[model samples]
Target: MRVSRGVPSVRFVTALATVWGRAWGGSVSFDDEFGLFVCSGMRGGFARGGTTVGGVFLTRRPPTRALLRHESVHADQWARYGIGFAVRYLWEELRNPGSRNRFEIEAGLADGGYRAERGITRPDEP
Candidate 1:
């Protein structure tokens, strides 16, 4: 997944994640426990979870099944789009901030633990 000398390099991100994760008291593992790279000790920035530059998932705490599922959706997105994923995501967010963004909507508000702030609801909810 490493692209040599490119705008978006997976290897670059992976390498950075190793150091970054360790700095935050986390580590990177090969197992796709959360369907992608999971960093255990990330803080600030992404309160819930975020896909890093190299498609790594950094969470403030251990992710629950629901949170993992939500982040997995984003992982799939990154996989499908590769480096362009962030651009597309940013574009969508810029066009429509908050839960209204289709990506976030697709990820599920509750699944990503954004139900309250984003005002998201499941189809089953009233």
Candidate 2:
């Protein structure tokens, strides 16, 4: 899975997890720091989970299922790469900026999943 610059959702979450590792468990909650993130990516956000290997931040607001997938993939991303994986993740994305290979890219794809209300894009790519 790769870091997403756009929003995330649940559909993408599942895919990203597949690339990194099987998800043992996951959930959503509110946070003053980033609003939303996977347990693994919670590292260093205003959120309480603290900096994990993934440690991602949504900064603006919480997203929908698409956002969930976006963040969840990050969870698996850390699981696959370790705390230092962020740099590598960036490197990979930079090296290959294509959705065909990246989780976030897949997340935003037409087959990707998204919420109905966000208006960020069409709901449920699949």
Which one wins on lDDT? 1
lDDT of 1 by residue, 1-126 (tens): 222223455445556766777677675654355546677766543433555445556756777778767776666666556677779989998897767677777767777766545455544456
**Clashing pairs counted in every model:** 0, 15
Candidate 2 structure quality by residue, lDDT tens digits, 1-126: 433333244335434543332132333333333324433322223332222234333322334455554555555555555545557656876775434335445335433332223334323454
TM-score of each: 0.68, 0.40
Clashes of 1: 0
Give model 1's TM-score versus the native structure.
0.68
lDDT of each: 0.63, 0.40
lDDT of 1 at 60: 66
